[model samples]
Target: MTPSLTEDGTLPAPAGNVIVVEESDMVDLFGVWDLVMVVSGVAWHLFTVVIFGWIVLRRHHFPPFRTRNLRLLGFMLACGILFWVCQVLTSLTTGRPNLPRAVCVLISPWLAYGLGLDLYMTILAYRLYLLYWLLVLRYPLRQSRRFYLFPILLGVPTALVLVSATASPRLVSTTHYPNPGNCVYSLMYSALCVVDVMIHIIVLLCLNYLCRHIEATYNDYRETTFGSIAFILLTIVAVNVFIWIGIGPPLYGYLFDREEYLAQFCVKLAADGLSCQGCHRRVDGSSSARLSYPPANPLHQHQYQRPTLPPGTGSYGETRPNDDNNSGQEDGRGTPGCSDSRTNGCRGGDDSLVEMAPTSRGITQQPADKNGHIEEWSLAHVAYHDDESNQLADKDYTGTSSAPHPPQHDRVIIE
Candidate 1:
């Protein structure tokens, strides 16, 4: 049976007109501090919900509760709600104090008892996931499946022990007290917090190992994506540390004073929200920048033109023998023939036009050779013999050399 106290130091009339004496020692439940806690708690909870909704909407899946950051965020929101409930209960039980003190005293115990523990657990889960990933990634892709079984075996037992120890009814009552602020104390709760710290340490070490493994595996890719990701993770760790250090102990103090809880929650709401925003930058650059190169510099673009080569060369601009009539037989030793009709020195029209063939602006891809080898030959290698006089004069001498000059006397031919 619950005790209903009347301020007059006697039980109120059970059936007659009873004056329910309001104790001056007891404060009203609604006041400035409670108003702040309600506002801040409501705002943060909504912010978390909005972010979570965005994630789910973007991914079109159940919100990723398993991810480390997201999971921590969820836990924080949950803790906030739990703290709110505790404040409400305290208000109800302690003859309804003014808002701030009422809220603080009620929510303090839950915050002290479980909030940090929850965050610590979240970090541990994430770190363990990272460790598993590293172990899997360390081996060949085919053998990674062999490494996955260990997490389930280890994780289940650890979780079971933590949950069973904390959730016991006897343990729940020990951490709380009845003098306006109730707290339950049990080895389970204490052990849980200790485990949280230890696990967080382990996870932090695992994160270091995971990052080292990533650096080792992808030495080149580490500079760009890895740095960004590392910054985000480090930021998360920093924020976690701030909260662990900043909000943690104060929460215990607030368990005895509702006003303090509201104040702390309000301050935390601002600081942590700002920290989250700073930490959550998109990893990839903007979509437009990712898909396209930056605009070309107009001033620099005008400085260069495609170079021309001697006559009778392939599209790659390499000089071929006059007798090398097989225009399509581009082997691996040489570059692929240019397909642009403007550079028709081999079989098409004006050779001069080939030199002036408008270059592909964004990218110039080399065609594959006869053996399917693609060589990106520079534009300077192709020749242009658009002049009629040069064309007619070179047309009569078809021995092998594309140039009108005779073979050097020092050149030796064994064939």
Candidate 2:
């Protein structure tokens, strides 16, 4: 039998193979691939870090930051940074010579746990956006901070990370070539990718459902900022799914690949920046749409007219004369049962015959009967009735005689 390959040794070609590859060729290949991964990973992460930093620093420019959803999104970006750092360190340490084993051990768990947490936070950020949209539409659903924040953002992800760590404490372990280096870690990483794929699918479904609901419910759906953000999120999820499928499998140590990280970084940067922009637009729109009510002015009270009674009706529905009869009555100094002098004004016919004077403060109730006592009515009910009374008092004073109304009489009637 042919000699078996050692654990750390390179594998020989198959018997039928004619080409012979040199050891130098294999070393060069591995070195080139590792360098590519490191460079690409660093560039992608640096770009993402800069974009996220800008968003956070200038969050005030985005009005949605005033809402809780943007705060959750900010937290998610923070988790993404942590995940990227741990993943980059782990990838750098692996398949490299002269690295401290202790450092690898420390980074491995963090990378695993951070991966889980980051995935959870991304889901949470989108979910919060949905909730906020529903709230703005006045949907009757539970949106308390205790309900969404502590339980979903804090409790569930922590539990998942703890359980995953406990179940797979040695998530990454060193291995020799020919046996495939760190095959177990690669498999675990692939599992994470699979989970991410599932999450993206769920998110896609939710976004589609929400978009449809919004389109059906709102007339200005296409013009809304939330609608634009929803579309962006849909695109991001689709891109994420494609990246996961392309690089997630560990068929040949492609798990946690640099290309995959770069794809994710681009998607996140676009989504976050667009979301902030949408929020800023929404704030501007709402402020411009607000309606303001004018304050009440007592001087404008004369513009309001009260309902009028029929021609023959006096104050409080008492039968009275037409204009001709009123002129005859005025010439006789008053009506038959009235004894008041013409200069003294009407009095004592009915205590309810009252008139309102439009004062600087408001309408003031004064008895039409000179000897009648004054009583106040609530301002809330004064508008309709008081305006009518003022009109009637003006007619009585002017129509009572053909002479020009005295200036003192005008002040007393309208003061």
Candidate 3:
């Protein structure tokens, strides 16, 4: 009769497929598939560890890695590296294909709770933060107080998932003692898996919203350096999902298959690199964009207008003059109660006139007012000097006002 295949290759009845075997028999039964599985799993774990280490070291060297989002990124990467290492090592020693079950049993409840689901949730949460900043806040992203929230949100859910996962026995081990550890397939573990899928979907949606927001805010405008980097990041996220969905399930059923696992590992590493690139791209791009424009100079752009009042203070001085009044009141000087003697010199329609004396022996005229002094280099002053010279020449021809008494007055040459 055909024998039942027990967890450790044991049989209930003596049959054609069954053979009396010890631990050595078990090792032989493991075969090529087992060796391949073990090697590939170990390699993948190692690769992840190396990648995570590199990320941490690089972040420390530079400051962008120090951001809250990036910090959470490090945590997630570290968790993934640790998770895979534990799962792969346990499977290799025991010669089993069901690693998730082994992980639930052997690994610390705290790590199992936080490391896996928490990290996965973070990817989505980070995306959501980006979305909220762009859409709701409508504020340009700079280093601000918003980054601190990441660790708290990430930690809470991870702790809960771990607690729930460990609370159920079926999620960790399927069979009782005397049987080789049975790789469990249970509801709690399945829930964790579902969470993974849902979080990914949320991340994708957030990315979509981000793209749309960018389009709306910067429509027809030239794309910034940050824009390009953000696009690359989005591309990487997309690629990550594609690869995980394509390769993840195949490896689950056939963990003993070495070639397939290695392929998955390679894909995962590439995806992680993409994620790092995305983050740095955004950070560097933002910095570059920030430093791109020089501070605006009002002097260079236009003639400097003296600050008369606070910003947005209405132009209170621009109203047209009322002609009915004898005294020019509302020309930013004399009004109802206030008196201004300067208006006497500014007679007739000419607002530019300033009476000055020819300071000489016989010619006795009042000195020019220091308060109404115009700059010698000014265009108005230069024009007035020329016009005054012409007027003096005309007066001489008409025999009206006599020329200055040069003998009596030592003329101070106006240089």
RMSD of candidates 1 onward, in order: 30.7, 33.9, 35.6
Candidate 2: give the clashing pairs: none
Which pairs of residues have clashing backbones in candidate 3? 113-162
Q: Against the hidden reference, what TM-scores do the models get?
A: 0.31, 0.34, 0.34
List where candidate 3 sits over 4 angstroms from the true fold.
Answer: 1-70, 90-103, 106-113, 127-131, 134-159, 177-180, 211-415
- Deviation from native of the Cα of residue 164 in model 3, angstroms: 2.5
Off by over 4 Å in 1: 1-31, 59-120, 127-170, 174-181, 186-188, 215-415
The lDDT values for all models are 0.41, 0.40, 0.40
Clashes of each: 22, 0, 1
Per-residue lDDT for 1-415 in model 1, tens only?
7567699877545555433334575545577866776689678878878887687457545433333345554565565566565555554445442333223422433453345344434544454455446564655535567555644543553455445544554444421222222344467655755665565546545555555544433322234356448868999998798778877777675566544343333323332222112111112322110111111333321222334545655434433333123444443333233233323422332232222121122112233346544333232222334343354111111122222221111111000
Question: What global local distance difference test value does model 3 have?
Answer: 0.40
Q: Write the per-residue lDDT of candidate 3 for residues 177-200, one digit (tens) a residue.
A: 223443554776767756754655
**Considering TM-score, where higher is better, how would the candidates rank from best to worst?**
3, 2, 1
- Give the alpha carbon lDDT tens digit for every residue of 248-342 in model 2: 65333324353333323322332233211221111224311111111133332222223343454323222222222233332232222122442
Q: Judged by TM-score relative to the true structure, which candidate is superior, 1 or 3?
A: 3
